[model samples]
Target: MIFLSMLRLMVHDGFSLTDATPYRHLVSGLQYLSLTCPDISFTVKKLSQFMHSPSKTHCQALKRLLHYLKCTISFGPHLCRHPSHHLYAFFDADWAGDRDDRKSKTGYVVYLGGNLIS
Candidate 1:
């Protein structure tokens, strides 16, 4: 159940599906879940990109994601107490990670009082 990362090697060369299992809906629901489950945010973002033209491979990746979520349904974030009122944040980016558009992949997590706020 430890989906350390959802860095799938997806591409835009796959065959499109006509009756994809309502991928847009499923991914949108997952998007809502990612609000609390920060771990799945990146994967959901990746999946959401195919809403316009999803393929069979995308569906498989989504099934794996759903399976991981079901297995980790009981897990939650762990927040520890701190002595100071300082805000801590960390971010990372992969510059030009997207081969299609040369867009960067960036994400950040904001913590307040040892709690993740974003």
Candidate 2:
């Protein structure tokens, strides 16, 4: 599953990633893309975890993301002017989900007029 891979990517530095790259631009660029493409937001967030020490594997992931973006250029969430009347926010927290750092994991999803806005 992609979720497992995302977690795996962060847990252990890729052994195959011997060649590190200065990839701030690529990572930041993909981060900007997350604004329009929510689908890649999680992956971009995962990639950001290693901004200080990006590896060759990270660069490859960035390249793959760029290719995916190019292929689905038209796919992006839209904010309708005539949005529904209701706006709401919901969130969840898992206390210390990561065993390594004991960092609590939190997540949220906001909706406007029953449409997922976050």
Note the Cα lDDT for every prediction shown: 0.82, 0.74
Q: What TM-score against the true fold does each predicted structure earn?
A: 0.58, 0.53
Query: Distance from true position, residue 107, model 2, in Å?
Result: 14
Model 2 CA lDDT for position 88: 90
- Estimate, for each residue in 1-117, the C-alpha lDDT of model 1 and write its tens digit: 344434653656378888756988899999999988878888889888888888888888888899988888988867778776778899999999999999998999998876876
Error of 2 at 60 (Å): 1.3
Window of ten residues with lowest summed lDDT in model 1: 1-10
Model 2: per-residue Cα lDDT over 28-91, one tens digit each:
7878878877788998898888877776667677777777778878775666665567889999
Model 2 TM: 0.53
Off by over 4 Å in 1: 1-13, 77-118
TM-score of 1: 0.58
lDDT of 2 at 3: 36
